[model samples]
Structure formats: structure tokens, C-alpha cells
Target: MRSWKRRGPTYCKDTWGCPRSQRKRVVFNKFGQPIGKIGKKFTNFLGTVARLGAELPIDQFDWRQVPNEKKEDAWEVVQDYYDVDEMHKSWTLSNIGTKWKDWKCYLRKTYFDPGFPCTDDRVIGDQWTGLYAHWQSSLAQKHSITNKANRSKQVMMHTNGTQSFACKRYDLEKGSGKVLSRPELFKLTHTKKNGKIVDKA
Candidate 1:
């Protein structure tokens, strides 16, 4: 397993907030791109109403809004506000607070065990990859980091003053995966056209 994870960017210049991370996510994807780089910053809730009418021109009488048609350009304001806006609003609202993981998990790419010369010529890598961890694994449990500095490192805190890292990893394996749910697995097996797999598990 890798010993350390590269922390998030110190600045927003590298990858803009929420878009890159939530691009694959539904709620933010529907949000229209920020006008003049001022994303989702509406002048007011009524302003949002005005913009939606101006953009979609949905007639109250006809009520002809279609599915997935406006998905990419849907308004976050609309989605978060009206119950009719989101497809899964009920589910989202139901899980307002919950504990997810119970232990920390790490990953490292290597050809041999610890203390071995990594470049040993005999060493080789394999494909068909997945992580190996038991049922209760997390990258952020037990550690108490309520201090401001640790929170700056993306540490999550509870009301009880305990802390945990906010990091996450994909259990690419198919079955018996912890936190397995509706989301697809992050599996990368074969190399692309000319890419090489230096190491894999």
C-alpha cells in the first residue's frame, strides 16, 4: 500500500472546486456553469427563479419538463429547493447524518515485501487489480484531530471531539467490498493504447 496520499491542492488554480470532484456526481453536474466564473452564485433565490424561467421557459400551464433533457443544465438551486427538482431528493434528505467507516486503509505499489530492493530485476507486476481489506476499513478512524491544523488537512470531526481523515479509496474488487453501494467501482486493469502498468495488485 502507498504510505502517503498527495494532499489536495493548496490553491484552486489546479482544479476548480466541486466540478472536477463532482463532475461525475449528479447534484453539481446539473448546475449551470458559473457566469463569468461566478458559479452558482445567484443574486437571490428569486433571481434563480427569474433565471430558470428565462432559460427553460417552462410554462406553468403545459408543464412539459422532460427527464435528462435539462439534466446537464439543471439548476442547483432548483434541485436543492423544490422536491420536484431532484430524482433522489427524498433519499438524500433521509441520510442527513450517518457514520460510514471504522478503520484506516492504505495502498502501496511494490514488487516485493518491505526492505527488499524495489528495482530487483526479477520483480514483476500483475494485472486484474483490486484492494485487499477486511469489512471494517477506513483511512480516517480513531485519530482525534479536532484542532484547527488537522482540520485544515481535511480531517473530519464528530460532535464528541474525535477526528478522522476525510480521505477515501475505491475497493475495486467486485464482491464483499466495504461501503459498496450504487456507485460503480474504480477498476483499471489493462493499460491504454501505449501505456504501461509498472505495478498493480
Candidate 2:
């Protein structure tokens, strides 16, 4: 039996629930990168799809400018690794675009920054060698610094630690059996795991 899952955008094809046993699994290396195609985590598979399929300037390319053909191509690739149906194509396309943007930000923070162990090109391995050049470009550096400065000016920062906002919203909705309001989501996101408010002022 087919049923809609109330947890965020997870669409379950089962009547009981979308258990982990039903979903695709992914194998990861020590660096957390996917090792293969099918049976992988959705986000990692999507990340791999973006890295392999999309071709754009790493520094300042916009998703809006990406051709529909490219997105369609990406969608087809995702279908090979995920259980997503054709009915979910629109959502999957948008999700892919968002994931692509997030991947660029992550690459900048991980490879361009000073602290991470994966910052060095000599040991970054062949998979990331293509991105190493782009991250080293002056344009990428400018954008990274500008984005960092802008982020520092934001007052209401979420205290969810490693938990993503989507996951948090999904969990909250699953427990409550209803969609969360914008205000409720904001409050929950700003609250820490210890039940303390993140920004009291």
C-alpha cells in the first residue's frame, strides 16, 4: 500500500512506515564520501550526482542558470540510486539544486579553510582534485570571505548542532502528527538539545 509520510518530504511506499530496511543504503569511506552508486544514502548520492553531472563555475554559478536539460539528466541519474518515483520528479529536481548549492558551500568551508585535515591537495585524493583548483581560485576566495562576513552579522543562529533543519522539522512533525508552523519551527531550531534557549535576548 502507498501512503504519504508526514515526516518532511519522505514519501513512503509502505503502509506500516518507511523503515531503514526499506530505504537504500550507502557505503562511505573514512572521509564520509560514498563508495558506490545504489544502496547509498540519499544526500550523499545526490551530492555525488551533482559533482559528476553538473558543470559550472564553482565560485559564482547560479542554479537558475543551469539548463533544464542538465537538471533532467541529473534527475535520471538520481533515479538509478533512489526509490523516488516519477511523480516526485519536480521535488527531486529542486532538492538537487538546493543540494548542489550546499555542496559548493561545504567544499569551500572544508577545502579552502585552514582547520580541516582535507585541506591539502597533495593528500585530497583524485576524486577532489578537480575541485581543488577551483577552490584555489581568487574568485572563490573572495566569495567565501564575503559569505563568512555576512554570516557573522546574523543574530539568530540555530543551535541544532549537527542536526539539519529539515531533519529536525521531520522529527517534530512525526511526533506531533501535524505540520509545524514557521514560528514553532523557529523556536525549536533556536532551542538547544539541553532545553535551554539559544538566544534569550
- Residues 154-182, candidate 2: write the lDDT tens digits: 98788866454566666677688998887
lDDT (tens digit, per residue) of candidate 1 on 1-201: 868865431222222234433332322222221111122231122232322432323221112332333323344433443322255543322221110011001112242124233342211212101112211134312332333366587532222111111111122322346653322222222233355432343
Q: How accurate is candidate 2 locally (lDDT)?
A: 0.59
RMSD of 2: 12.1
Candidate 1 clashing pairs, residues 3+ apart or interchain:
1-107, 1-108, 2-107, 2-108, 34-39, 103-138, 104-138
In angstroms, give how far residue 31 of model 2 lies from its true place: 33
Query: How far is 75's C-alpha from truth in model 1 (Å)?
Result: 13
Per-model CA lDDT versus the true structure: 0.26, 0.59
In model 1, the Cα lDDT at residue 29 comes to 22
Best by lDDT: 2
The TM-score leader among the candidates is 2
Candidate 1: misplaced stretches above 4 Å? 1-3, 6-87, 99-201
List the lowest-lDDT window of 10 residues for candidate 1: 96-105
Residue 63 of model 2 has an lDDT of 82
